[model samples]
Target: MSPARAATSVVDVVAAALRERILDGDLPPGERLVEGALAADHDVARHTVRAALRVLAAERLVVVEPHRGARVAALEAGDVTALYELRTALEVEAAHLALSRHEGRLPPAVHEAAASLAARCRVGDPRWVRVSEAHTDLHAAIVRASGARRIIEAHGALAQETRLFLLRIRPHLGYARLASEHEELVADLERVGPRALRAHLRASAAVLVDQLA
Candidate 1:
């Protein structure tokens, strides 16, 4: 690879690690980020670490201070509400569009993923990370099925924001109602049309908003 390609790869690696820590709450909101420490942890140079932090700062994941340092971004009550609002609109839209696009039945992978979600609920996982992956994939499947470009982008942004709040909430929330909700969503998609799915999605979003409240 060229010099530029190598540099980009290093930056991407640093960025991904930092992003994971941020979303996972290892780097909690208002936590200071020591550049040299992060560089050592990631096995990258300080310059590379700085470059990665800058990208996250631009994403509002971190607050960068010149001559000071960077810290994790905090999500306030209003921020939570805004995130859920966006999630509600885009996810409901995606569900509606995807159901409309489905000619007769759900696609195989989607059906399987939905079934897996049901199974996950029955088992009752205590691990937040495991719960999150299932939640993320289910939403991704719904949005991807729509084949809508801008809607997918919007959903992606909301998912990122949701991850931050989940960092704080997941340990306490557990994986019960969420699992049943997934089963219900799958059943709704199977029985009713997009309209009912949209209603279900909206109600689901409302639950998250209430959680924030």
Candidate 2:
């Protein structure tokens, strides 16, 4: 591989590792990501670590200050609300389009995602990361069902931030409740249309915002 390509690959690996740590709550919000420490930990050059941090910052997973370096990004109450607002708009429209374009039937992947969510929750001791992954998968399936490329791309852009928010509120939203709510939403998407999705998103946003208070 060319030098530049090898360097870019290393940056992606480091960034993905750091991103997982942040989302899994191993690196809590406001925790400083020291470049030197990270470089040593990942056995990469300090410049490589800097490049990885920049990539994560672009994804809104890290906050890079002028001299203070990088820290895991935190979602304030307002940020939670803003994210859910945008999520609701995209997801609800996607639901509507799915119903209209597919003859009022959601694609099979939506059902599959819902089932995976329930299965994750059904584990003896559910891991928050697994539950959050399943939850995000279900929502992504819904958006993909819309068959709109731009809508799918827009929702995909929110995936990392959404997972961060989910990690914050996972304790409040118990696994059972999360599974049941999504199962119902999937059912309602076929029978009742996009309103069910809007209500679900709004209710989830309210819970997150309330917890941040």
TM-score of each: 0.80, 0.95
Candidate 1 stretches with Cα past 4 Å from truth are 103-105, 116-127, 192-213
> Which of the numbered candidates is closest to the native, going by highest TM-score?
2
lDDT of 1 by residue, 159-202 (tens): 65566666666544456777776767777776775666657545
The residue ranges of model 2 lying beyond 4 angstroms of the native Cα positions read none
lDDT of 1 at 13: 87
Error of 1 at 194 (Å): 5.1
Clashes of each: 0, 0
RMSD in Å for all candidates: 3.1, 1.2
Clashing pairs in 2: none
* Candidate 1, run of 10 with poorest lDDT: 124-133
Query: lDDT tens string, model 2, 66-146?
Result: 978999999999999899989988999999999899999998999999999999999899777778888889999999999
